[model samples]
Target: MSENPHDQPETLEHPEEALHRRAIRSFVMRAGRMTDAQKRGIDHGWPRFGLSLEQGLLDLDQVFGRQAPRTLEIGFGMGHSLLEMAQVAPDQDFIGVEVHRPGVGSLLNGVLNAGIDNLRVFDCDAIEVLNRCIPDGSLDRVLLFFPDPWHKKKHNKRRIVQLGFAEALRQKLKVGGVFHMATDWQPYAEHMLEVMSAAPGYRNLAEGGGFVPRPEERPVTKFERRGERLGHGVWDLKFARSE
Candidate 1:
């Protein structure tokens, strides 16, 4: 019997673990409505482009059909920019992990429309995907752009940039591999800086040991553009794993 493609488990070996994950999630799966096109995209594109949590650890070379730089983007909301990176970097293979079904469907639609072949997606929690599937020290780059800020003071604990998260991320990245993150929320950015600075086995890539200017490859998202127009500042942090 085949595994249910729709079940986004935290651990493929223990689907029961998903219940506890929901309580600690950095994101609250938005009950967004999926458009007909998005639904159709999942129907037509998932078989070719979607990856399941149930699939367990993946062989990057085998998955992409060739040896190449592997990049993973956590919470690639809607995937417009994720697709852009994949389109521009043909030599790299990208695996995007996102939890929202609507976003997954929407991205799948884009994958179909663009005729892209160098990307695959996991519709599950980023932590789970990292813990159970992605091999240690296998990724060359990890992109984490605009993750939820969890604004309220009471919810700051929910932010994904905690010390433990940073440590785990450091372990997964190959030596000299880049861990890049960007956020429009200033407070959250500062939080990121503090945590990442304290995390061992990594070095900041920015000058003066502070936030860096957005790199050329990171296309400004629609929400980010809106924030810019409204006088909001965006922070980019790039840290390399150090052995």
Candidate 2:
């Protein structure tokens, strides 16, 4: 007797394929897990402090007591670099976007512990925040350090250096604003160069074919340390929004 189609187990798609689909959905649909408590805390925990898309363009003068150029750091893993930057540059406002719950919580705890008041965070998709919330040409600098490379050949499309996202970032940054990105994955780094090079209204800031060394303001994060121990090469790419 032939095995019934209904009785046969379905061969699931490859995990990488599934992850890529999920990533695309996460970007397009803006659907990600956040518990009610997390939502409430994100909404009301800092009261007059934290920002969200619903609140609209933040009044920087009112929030920080003086208008300052704003810098955005996407996926600030454990906030090590972000916190360090905030401390180093008190005159510039830093907004960090991260999806990891524990990381966000840890950053918030660190902020309270350090009594740092020049930083704010949003625990959601950076694209969503950039598209619906932040005003155009509002950011002075944008940093993306060591984003997941999706190293597999079949999963390269899942990487964040696509044209659409780069264009979106270009629009969000002010004229002459800097867009800095770093990654340890060479292929992803090359992919980033290709995408950003093709992106309109932006120009590469590097003097040579490669990017400059990491800025002194940024501190190495735990992830970077681990990657360094594992002998992964790191690359940094910087682009400026053109007039």
Candidate 3:
């Protein structure tokens, strides 16, 4: 008897390729309403500060106009916090990846308006960008703040902080580089901790165990403040790549 087509042995993906595949994403695409300012931001400011998804590995030094500590942020909503981080740390180069067009435009506009020379924006998905553009061991730190919690039990797997994700992120960070994440949901925090702990080449920065105090480097955003007002607890997890 011939074997059914579905019964054929499946080819396994390389570990690296499997690391980037997401059957379920933590966030839904929401470009939202693009105000005139945001439209203008992409139209005018992009020529100066925006990076195309099609562009491959960047020359970090040339992009920032100097060799500096490089930080990459994923899903920077509205771009306010990213702008703040870039503004406060003038010596560091900041690269933001956000899929939302309105948010991308907002950040680009803010970068132009603030006269910030140390920032760049990627209007694209982070996983693909990281795989294509970011070179291994080139980043100083990676920031992922307030990623969608995907609260339902069945939806939890859609969360981005999986063990494979930790590994992929680790490859991008230099030795001793940091990956800092914050979430207002408790269960997701626990989930994040479990994944990060199992992933090798990283040491938790939260002395001894559990969660850590929110680092000062992550300035509070309007959304966080609003969540606080609603009595939502926040969790911060920081891990550094092993030397």
lDDT score of model 2? 0.72
TM-score of each: 0.90, 0.80, 0.92
| lDDT of each residue in 1-243, candidate 1, tens digit only | 222223232222232333224445577766778899889878998899888778888887888999989999999999889989998999889999888888889888988888879999999888888877888889999999999997987667777777667777776789999999999899999999998898778899999999988899998899899999999999999999987
Candidate 1 segments whose C-alpha is farther than 4 A from its true place = 1-23
The lDDT, on a scale of 0 to 1, for candidate 1 is 0.83
Question: On a 0 to 1 TM-score scale, where does candidate 3 land against the true structure?
Answer: 0.92
lDDT of each: 0.83, 0.72, 0.83
lDDT of 2 by residue, 171-215 (tens): 778999999999888888998898788777788888875676877
The residue pairs that clash in candidate 3, if any, are none
lDDT of 3: 0.83
lDDT of 3 by residue, 136-239 (tens): 99999999999987797766666778766777888899999999999999999998898788778899999886788978989899999999999998999999
Question: Model 3 shows how many backbone clashes?
Answer: 0
